[model samples]
Target chain A: MEVQLQSWQNMKLAQVPHMLAGHAMPWVLAARRSAFERFAAHCFPTRREEEWKYTDVSIIGRRSSLAPDHIPPDPSSEAKLLAWTLASESLYLMVFVNGHYAPGLSMTDDLPAGVRMASLANILENGADLPESYFDPQHEHTIFAALNNAFATDGMVLDLSPGTVLKAPIYLLYIASGHGVAIYPRNIVVAGEDAQATVIEHYMGTLDAHNFTNAVTQISLSAHAEIEHCKLLQEGPAATHVAGIHAEQASDSHFISHSFALGGRLARNDITAQLLGKSCHCTMNGLYLLNERQHLDHHTRIDHLAPECISREYYRGILDGESHGVFNGKVVVHPGANKTDAHQANHNLLLSRQAEVDTKPQLEIFADDVKCTHGATVGQLDDDSLFYLRSRGIDAELARSVLIYGFTNDIIGRVNMPELRTRIEHLVLERLPQGDQIKELL
Target chain B: MLTIKNLHVSIDDNGNGKEILRGINLNVKAGEVHAIMGPNASGKSTLAQVLAGREGYQVTAGSVRYLGQDLLAMTPEQRACEGIFLAFQYPVEIPGVSNALFLKTALNAMRKQHGLPELDAMDFLSLVRERMKRVGMDEALLSRAVNEGFSGGEKKRNEILQLTVLEPRLAILDETDSGLDIDALKLVADGVNDMRSPERSIVLVTHYQRLLDYIVPDVVHVLSQGCIVKSGDANLARELERHGYSRVETENTAKQVA
Candidate 1:
């Protein structure tokens, strides 16, 4: 609880002096007036708050005390950051530096006929936008998201025409290179009726620069529309990340979101999916691997607001060294949402004796006729399985490494995108302590 | 080629222990198959586990020599590299790993330990295809996760396929015939028979004589109270099948005096 005050009262306002002197145009400054006011009224949440009890952001706030510098990153470091991308021939790559759209690093080709990809600045300047009804306050549940809304400079926007089938996926990469800085980025996606596309948001750092990234993404899918959204978080070690994703699925629409967390000193993701139309389906899957003194948290909510909607969620974590992981998933079925089917599961594998995992899967059903189940498991590797492999001539240490890889690989393998799947596999393998043992595996 | 001298094993870490493998002695040379048959609670499986160097069993007194080398002194992988294989009654399911890939890694590990070239993908494919046909396994099974969602028969067949790929000099099958139908038993037996060679040895541990009917052993040993009380040709298996294990144990005591 003491840590909460440090992160909120002191660190939240420390950057105000530095930010006020920062450069911005008159029109852009005018646009952010309301956002800055909203941020001032609502500060960071304390540990006493039920939603933030398990995760203390005070450590992150202390780290964010140093103001972010606007100086662009070096060319060599930018090349290294782009090297981690696994984009394919059909992907339209959009790159960002210091949370601002970087046109020089981005590549645009093979775009669909009725699809638009533009920066938030351009959208604001040209007056293009999503329906006003889609915008809602999510920061009431997460104070960091409100901070992101308050400081967001610019972001990416996607607009699809009805009945358009995108042949290639859109790749959005976010890079941070400044030292002791904070960057807020936002992404808005709208899928017209009967449209289908896949979007990949990748995060990486150009240098070992100490920084903070606060991001918010809002997605709205029309009836009969489908969207596959995947986020990859592989930030720098000294960095802190706070991200929130809000998705609204209409009747006959399908939305799938996959989050892979493998970065930062402290990271937390808040994901919400609201099924507002009948026969809608939403699947949320996530995998997190942490080591060193890192802390990672995931809070997911699925609201079954309409009848006959189905939702499935599975989140897995592997904590090593002195790391900590937390999972809090809740499925809410409102009244009159009969025939709703929802399932949530969280599984954690603790590698070291000192590693810890806190998991809670909650299911609250108000409808009379609905099926809901939730379970959480935290345990070490199976001794029987390990012995089975050792008895076959594999060394005990190698056997443990293989089992660990196989455990997390199940979730990574669930990704339908082939290139992205392979990239995540490589990243996961590289992050393991016994990465050398897996060279033979690949 | 294996020799066990006064082999004794005890379960549990307790120092004041009840010995599982009492003073037992056995010897077998190349070009022969030996079957160890016993009732439930007997130490037939313990003997196989000890020979494979699995943990959790304390060897109070014993020395085992395999092909003129100290078997118990070597690590599990070392024994594997030296051509020792165990076909488990219940194979472990390894998810997210393809059958072909798992086999290739195991095969290459053994090959590398033996100073041989690692088998490439095409070479492994050719080798697996032949083994699959002999085991009556569908070729498509190799692309799926190892033993995951596989039928009982398929799992057994997959075990046989791995055995064929490894081709160890000594194979100790720990109740491989425990869970199988008549057709599956025949297919598995055929796979074992095809693997038989003049320079290789086999030890089949089973509670029933059905497996011996297909792959007849050169010798059948009856293990009772952690010791071998009777040893004879394949006829011992048939007699025990007809008279039951209790009758055999009593008869062995009587024959000891005669």
Candidate 2:
């Protein structure tokens, strides 16, 4: 705990509120002056706070010593960080080095007509006038989100033309580099009316690199628009990754988000979707596999503001070694959101005796006629199933691993993208404690 | 070959030291099909369960010898590896496990324990395709989850299909014919008949003689009050079918037949 606090404090120089005022966000920093003042009036939540009770981020608070007055020139860590980005052949790649866009590695030539994809810095310098309206005006300094807003030096800015459908996925890689370095990478995606597209954000780092990633991404879907957004975070084991995703859905729009987290010593992912229009739909799915003293937490909130909107969420986790996992989900049905159909479930498989899980699935319904259900379960492999397998001559250890993987496979098999699914399967199997024991079985 | 002598069994879960098998005795040689007929609560299934080494059934006093080994001493899996198989009365539906995959795993496990080379996936598929035909089971059934979404008859045929694949030395069919139509009964009987060999034996547990009419066991024994009260050839099954258990008990009790 002390180690984590020290790490947090060391990151104070790169803190969101201070860094925002110091960097490219001067206009936003000035526009949200009162909000920033309100942010400063309240400190980050501690363990005593009920929302943060199960997870302790004080270790992040302790990393004040690592903070630097200014970003280092020619950061020695950029090379290793760039090499870890997913370089799949089919993806239209956009790379960010130390939170700065590196156009040298980007290949965005064949983007569909009327699509706008550019670095935030380019948009700001080329008289694009994104203005303060693009920034989340409703967001107060949320500590981490404010920190990301303050220090976001380079981010992907995407705007789709009305009724345009992109055939290929847009890949954005946010790489955090340098020892004791901290980065806040922000992304803004806006889809015009009747547009459809898929965007994937990759948060990655090199092996053993000590850094912090505080990122915020917002996606806006207009009337009749559809979007599929995915986030894959596989940072270095010594790194701390905190992210917030906010989505606003318009009339008859649809949004699907999948988040996969497989790295970092401490990681927390927060997602909030506001269904503001009638007949809008939102689906959220996540998979997290943690081992070897890792801590992973997922907090999701879905708000149905209009009638006839539907939201569904499913999340699964595999915890091994002494790792800890936390899942907190809430589905909110507003007064006018009658006939809202919302379902949320969180299931965890603890592979080791010391592994632990804290799960809370909630439904806050104001509309009486809505159908809302939520459930959370944490358990180990069924011993009867294990014995049944062992009776078929599978060794005890192999039998247990098979059942555990099979339990989590229910979610993995749902991932329709073959390559991503295969890669994730390998990653999950690699992190399992006795994964080798089940090789023959697989 | 399978042999049981003076077997005594008891269940102690409910704090009642009640005996389920009261000094029962039975013998079965290779190539023999012996049917144990009894009413409900007559300890018929208990005898089959004891032979399969199911947990929680205490063998208070008895000796069971299979292929000259201490059958009572072997674990369920060990008993399975040594060619002992039990076709459960109510097959458990494993939601995500495929039937063919399950049978392949069971077959390969037995083969591995016997020091035989395991079959490849293609070989296993071919083997399963052949055995399923003998049981008159639909080939499509293999692609489904094990017994999940299966009808009662499909589950019964699946058990017989397993019997045909494992080819255990002693097959204990625990009421395998309980919930079956006439067509399904013939298929199950055909499956059992195909597995009969000079080196294999079988113990069929049932409460009715309808199954016997199709399978035609070599011997039939009336099990009443936890003990065998009568033993005879195939004609005995026909007699019970004609006169019913009460009449058989009367005719046999009057003679004090063993």
Candidate 3:
């Protein structure tokens, strides 16, 4: 065990120089070096850690490597990948293949004014100051985040000017195309004062490969700005995904995050939002559907750093076969941050006895006058509800699917985008055990 | 259209089988409405549940025949598709499933079973709109989740709407008047009365005679200890209302002893 752990540390250290070999920018190289040092200083998390008690990352370390390699794109596979796009004329699509921007596949025509969108590599090569200021290497507390910062090849950089509102949504598509390769994707979004936009990050794997995706996203909202961000992970069955989202909201700003994880062998998502100004509001909603030995873990934290800030979070999970799910949510109200109102809830449904779930919802309040509430529940479908559906001429299997859909509808209903909601509803139903029967009902 | 002969039902209680319905016998012909009135805990609801093919009940003896088919052998959904409808005493709330979708699926299932074509969207809408007037249901209710956050009266009325759409050969109403007010009760009774036809049979199970006042039954059966003690006409319902259930219980006990 000791030798294996030592070799794991050495393996990560050896990849640092390879990560910064071709980078010419001093600041970018320094950032990578700092992130690699931090990653080397801390060992990979285990079940002993409180935050990782239910999830173990050793399998990821043993199976995935850091060295980057290119895979020739298959035209048929690329076409198959494009079929999953939102197929709407109003959508502004940005495509990334193997963590590098694919200009030929992107659609940037007719973009609204005051919107600056470019690849992260392009901005870095141009000596842009925005990427340097936004990327934080010292804040890497997790091994995956550290790895993402040190080795991220390319991602999307979106900037919205003050008072700018984009009528159409922006879609960022990340496709993993090769086997046994590790890809780091870094995305940054900055919305100026009174600006509003909706952005969706869709990660998919084109081949049935044993791959790993380590993603990091940073979002900053200026005063009175509002943004709706969505993250969807539907990788190949043999893929492992780990993602982190960090958001900061200014006074009177609103931020809503929606995450749906439906595929991958093992997946973990961590999100944190800091309400730094008065009257800022933040909402987080997530859903995970797993089956056949799949595992998913979600961790969310909301900090009320100023007075009159509000936070609401609700996450749900459905596990079938031998799958497992984990949920951990926390809401914190710092001192002097009075008038903070926060609500958090986590619900899980297990379709089989072999399926399991662990949930923890917590509220830490230091302010004297604050309203914070959190709850967690894990159970199966209501037998009465199932019988009710069966009594109305639906078969037992179809009835079970209907009840499961009903369980997830609570979270899906929170989606404000009708087309996206409908698409998600269809995807969720298609993943159900008896999905065919439920399709007619939907 | 329906026959029940010496039906006995029992349920598992702490690993011991406890009999809820000792023996029940009933027969109804086409175009007839039968009222089975009994006091509480006299197996009134059990009989309705047994006929509807609900689980958790073991039929120790007897049989039920509907249209010359073995009713007890079929599943709940199968029985439903074969024209058996039960208006629950306490309707279960199913969230996220719209009422219109529920009815449409059920109606299509029944129609397919009877070798008939399914109703399309336009035809289904018109049919439901015409039936909505019978129970005075709001058009918006059709789009809402089935019985979710619905008032007691509204839930009962929704059941009536389902019955009207399915057009079942045998309809069983189990204490449908329990939670309804006078006006709502009148509306429900009118809905039941509107469904009466030469090819349909109705069964009304109630504790009070008020529901019978609006939709009078051709035959009234007094059930005591899960056995029908007396059978009479519509006047018997009024007489029972005047005399109360205690008098009938005493007479039933006396007759059993003799």
Candidate 4:
């Protein structure tokens, strides 16, 4: 297993020196060096680890020398890139191709006043914040997070000032098109006091473009601030996706995350949030649809570190064919965090006999006066529910599609953005039978 | 409107057939109301399920004809579009599917089958609002997920609401009187009475004669095991209420021996 995972260690540091030399900032070099040491020390996780027991990433570890290359963007690659893009003209769009900023394809010129938004590489190369404050790396980092920090070439950074409110969401599209390409995107969002922003990140690739994408994002929300982060991972059919998101919310702040994993042969996402102040509200909603030989796992945790905080988590999955899906949710109400109200539920619908799901809910309540409830259910379409709908005049196929659509729409409905929700609905529809006809039913 | 001959029904348990209905025979004319009374596990619900084309039950030997067509050969939706409606004993709850959307879709699907144009949102809302008044149901329930979090009486009222909205020619009400109080029962009965016309027929499946008091049935049949042992006018339900099923069973067995 060590040898198989040594694919990253076996890769020459040649590409790193070249990428680092472009950004002569000493802190940039220092951060990269420390991250590399951490990455080397921890190595890749295996099935033996409790947090990753259900997700086996040996397939990713076996990749031969996973590193990004500056492949010249061709006309067809650009076309393919645009096909997977989810940004509208009304929103600010940033496109990163092959782990480097594609300035010609980006739409960041319309940023409002007091907004400090740029790519990480550009921030390091030109002039930027202090090294210690630029990247707020958590003390306890996973191997994948360390790897992303050490090797990422470019990523979106939205450093909003106090009282700044983004009228529209900022969209970031990251594409890994070239074969054998591995894109490590390290995104950071620091929302100051009373600031509000919505950040939409989409990781995508063509159907046959084999690649690996390891993304790490850290978000810090100040008092009274609100941040909604939505991510859609729709990579190629043979791609591997491993992502980690950590958020810290202050007093009276609101942080919401919506994660949709619909593609890739192997994918795993770990999202955690800490309610660090009184009256803080945090929500984590996710939906994953997998079929064929694809496998997806979602691990989510919410810690109520302050009194009288509220946290809610809801995740649903639709598994078909021979695919495998896993949902593990944990909500912890720390000691003295009294009056903490936490709720978590995970439900899955299996469409085929060969499809499988592993679901579990872990709730820890150390506080004496707290309300925490968690439930996990894995099942096929309810036979009675199906028959009830069918006993009406609805056709058999349309009834089936409507039930599936309703199952996923439960999560998508919480998105609040109609445009993003509609697009996500379309992506989910493509996986259903006669899904096009469901538009009429809706 | 309906004809049943030698209706022998059974459910498949593993590989063997567990019989529920044995060699039953009956006929129902248009514009008539018939009440079927029996004890628990007497195959009353199975009969309604089979009529509605529900799965998990097999007609080992039987023939059911509806409007001169073989009712057993139709799918549930096909039967529904063809004017067959069954009010389930335990109404199913469908989360995430609002009652308004479900009712609109169902009504439109039936209308499309009949070559009629579909109703828009406003028109459908008006129609449902009017029907909700007749069924004594809350208008707020239309926006809620179907049957979810509904009380037992509310679920029964919802079933009656669907019967009124769909306006099927033949309605089979299976145990619609079980979960309702007297007030709700009268309201539900009035909803059914409103739909009663010269072209429609109603089949009431109940254990007590109480529901028949509100909506009187022209005739009543007593099913003892898998067969209708004896039948008479509405008085038969009154007699069964006083004597219970054991007396009727004894008399039925004596008659069989004779």
Candidate 5:
């Protein structure tokens, strides 16, 4: 084991001390050292692994040189962020530029009492005390998450006290700029009993910038707490994004996750939910609109470890051009977890002949009294639907656009926030050929 | 306003064409309501689909003319743009698209086709609100997906709603009374009767003469074995209803010579 990864391991280990954030705090430094060691020990997950069977992460492994920028927001990138932040005034915005928290651009007006929001990097630099067990040593299930944990410079550490609920959503915006730049943004949320809120994690890069964004968000909901976690990846066209979302729901808590992957040359997301207590409900819904040569893969797992837990996973992909999409969702009902209900579905619509999708829905049920159902489909637009639209004076192209938009509405409609829903609707429409005309119809 | 001369349509299966509509001839003038009554598999619905230019139907022979133009040469949307409407027997349920948006898009598309300015959302909604109320289509359904989870009667009412909103010149009602109840049937029949005008021609295709009892047709044509075997005044529909198609079985395949 010493010689197996001595040189490569040392090379990656060198990035620990040089990481842009979390250096001043010894606990953070220790956490980073262990995470980097673990990441290097495993190298990068390959096709041999069951989870990474379809995706090839060799490109990321080669480009994983940690050169995160510690610079402030540029005028142009700030302008673009300002436009978005202004558009969603109802959301508390946390802005991060080049993996470091941007205090100038971050907005937290009207923050309620008992709600704690702070920059993890600042907390570590100031030598603040973190919540107990905040840094889970074994939570990094994949190399990407480990890498993020090790190389992450700055992140949002949100603490919602028990019985405290925010009426507005909390938006975390991470912007990366620079050629071949790699930025890791990690987020942690701790909600006490009966606490509820919606959090939007959006990762974007400057136009035409080549970058890699590896992000991880760990959320724990207390009893009766509800949290809607939305992850939107809109990086540059030449960018690569890898994200891991790990959530733990207590008894009677509700957790909803929506992953909208529109930009980036290659984007992969691993979303895992642990329903640890009884009567917890988790919903995982995602929509990916891919075009050109983009590639996206989503791997989701829902573990029902307690009795009477319900989990629903629905993911849809619309692929055009020569793009490829993949979705593998797994639902596991643990032993003796009776009365567990799990449903999983993944559907892909290929607009062009060359577009392709690989979809698989897995249900591993060890409990006899549990109910589990899974379905997957990869196909083109329904001819009947197209013809129906055309019969109403809508041309073939416009009809196709409307039907495609309609297919994605199932996921978008699940979002209760009007602003987020409209933004998602716009992105899905923007990928279609007749999007402009369809917009007028609405 | 519409004429079919020696029309034939077939569905291709394994490189073989099985004809559904044999050689047929018919003429429909403006402001006239013609009832095309036939038994199941009598090519009634196929004729309507072919008229609307739905794909999978290879027009093996014949020509259809509307307003002196080649009707068979247009596409489904083009046919709709040119003032032809076919209230589908089974309206397709399009999830995620609201009924109001569908109607607005269709109405604006037709208006744009006829060189008329498009209506804005407010004007369009106002126009739709009144017509939808007239057809008894609940205002709440306008926001719901098109025909998604709608009851049978509600679906029929939606069809009448579209018919009234579009206001086409040549309207073909294909089994519109199939799944509706007596009250719904009367409501739909009244909707159709209200739309009858001197500038428009209507075709009511039904398996029973029950629909004609509400909206009396000027002419009744009995289709058998893919051909109009019999044609007469409105009295013909009642005679065929009383005798049943078995009596008309003797008239099977007797092609009508126009």
Candidate 6:
């Protein structure tokens, strides 16, 4: 396996020099080189590893060449894609087309004081704080993260200074246009003490694009800062997406993450948060809707490294038409992290006999005095509920659809932003089997 | 308006078929209220379930006709749209579907089947409000999920509210008064009484005669061991209340043996 991975790395090495040639900074070059070494050292995970037991990424590793460097931009396609994003006037939009920043489509006119936002490539070229300060190549040993760092062309970077509170959210939209392309996007977000902000990352692609998106996002929250982060993946049906989010929370800081995965042939999300300060809190909520041979996996881990911290996680999935879903949530309470409170739950509903789901929630506690609980449930729509609807004159198919929508809405209802929640509700309903029929009822 | 002939019903429990109803026969005309009184496992509830087209119950030999059409041929939803309503003994709790949305969906389905226009939101709200008043139901229940976390009496009232809103041609109440207090029983009975009309027929299946004191039945039948042992006027219910079902079962058995 290691030999195969090394050979795979060698095949893609030809593109690195071209990528490196564009950057002159020594730290940037060294970071890329170190990331490449790490990628070459590790093999793509197999089912034998417990973390990868239910997912296989060999198809991703088998690709010999890097994605094509250029794809002509289409304005009509960009407009159509932008129509799905939030239309609020206060939003700051940054667009990325084919892994490169599209300055023509971005808008950042009314940003508040002490808030700085720009593309990573632009920031790095300008000699600002090195990207190494935000992301440590040595800390991320996963093959996909390493590959993303080594080959990423551009990404978004947002920073809020001390005591700064943004009145609007930052929207980062990533769009892929061509087939058989590999696009890596790296994002860095830092919040200073007592600051507050929200960030939304949306990924989309063309229907004909069979591309792979390897993305990584790192967030650092200082004391008393609060941040709400949301990621929406509505890629093309043939696309493959692998995303990772690593967050660090300081004392009394709060971080919440909402992940909605609706499209992709094979989509996987790995989220890890470290509560490194006392009295900090973190919340992770996710919803995945899959149909027609699509597969989605969500793996989350939260470590309570200090005392009096809280972590809560709730995830739900609706699978239909031979699709599959996997959810694995792990929480660890380190020694001396007393008074920690953690709760995690995952519920899934299968709409077809062929649809499947596997969910596992784990808790590891080294602290003696802590409160932690985890649970997972996978089931079909309730027979009694279906019959009740039918007996009230609803058709069988519409009844099933309504029940499914209701099941997913339980999680969507938790989203505090009404406009965004409504948009997500529409997206979820439009993807259901009998979406047309259920749309009328809602 | 309704007819049943030689109805035999069985259920498949883990591939083992068990007969629950044996050769049951009955008839009813329009504008008539009939009461079926029986002890446990007497097939009273099974008869109601069969009429409503619930799955997993096989009719080995039976014919149920309603309004000159074959009732057994339609699906449950089809039967519901065609004006056959069954108030379930144990109302199902749907956790996320609001009661108001459920009723509108149901009412619209029935209207579409009957070639009537669907109600708009305002019209639906007014219609449900009127029916809710008749059933003595709180208006807040309309916003909550269907029977989710509802008290026993509230669930029963919700069923009555649905019956009122649907306004079916044939109504069957299966043990609707089993878990209600006296006041709730009277409220439920009054709701049923309000729907009584020349074009509608009702069959009340219950174990107690107390409910009969509020909504008097036109006819009474004593069901024992999956068959009706006796059929009489409303006075027969009073007699059953005075003497236990054991006396009636013994008399019927003696007559059969003799």
- For each candidate, the DockQ is 0.61, 0.29, 0.66, 0.59, 0.75, 0.66
Model 6 per-residue lDDT tens digits across residues A204-279: 8888877889999999999999988999999999888899998999999999999999988888999989999999
Error of 1 at A59 (Å): 1.6
- Report the candidate with higher DockQ, 1 versus 4: 1
How close is chain A of candidate 4 to the true chain A, as a TM-score? 0.94
Assess every candidate by TM-score. 0.93, 0.84, 0.96, 0.91, 0.95, 0.95
- Per-residue accuracy of model 2 over A163-197 as CA lDDT, tens digit each: 99987778787666667677667788899999988
Clashing pairs in 3: none
lDDT of 5 at B118: 93
| lDDT per model vs. reference | 0.81, 0.77, 0.84, 0.86, 0.86, 0.86
Which ranges in model 5 have alpha carbons more than 4 Å from their true place? A1-13, A72-88, B252-258
lDDT of 4 at B132: 96
Candidate 1 residue runs with Cα over 4 Å from true position: A1-31, A64-68, A75-88, A125-140, A433-442, B13-16, B254-258
* Residue runs of model 3 more than 4 Å from their true location after superposition: A1-22, A70-72, A75-88, A433-437
Which digits, one per residue and each the tens of the lDDT, describe model 4 over residues A1-442? 6665455555664247346523477676777777777766767798899988888988877778666665535424554457346343678888888677777777787788879888887776775673465443573346787777677777878889999999888888877776777887878899999999999988888777778888888899999999999999888899999888889999999999999999999998989999999999999999999999999999888989999999999999999899999898989889888999999999999999999998989998899888888888988887777788878878888788878888997999999788888878888888788677565555
The chain A TM-scores for the candidates, taken one by one, are 0.90, 0.87, 0.94, 0.94, 0.94, 0.94
Candidate 2 chain A, run of 10 with poorest lDDT: A66-75
Question: For residues A117-185, what per-residue lDDT tens digits would candidate 3 score against the true structure?
Answer: 888877776777654655475445367788777777778888999999988888888877767777788
Give the 10-residue window scoring lowest on summed lDDT in candidate 3 chain A.
Answer: A67-76
Clashing pairs in 4: none
Q: What fraction of the native alpha-carbon contacts across the interface, defined at 8 angstroms, is recovered by model 5?
A: 0.75
Question: Per-residue lDDT for B76-145 in model 4, tens only?
Answer: 9999999999999999988777898789889988999999998888889899999999899999999898
What class would a CAPRI assessor give candidate 6's docking? medium
Q: Kindly state the number of residue pairs that clash in model 1.
A: 1
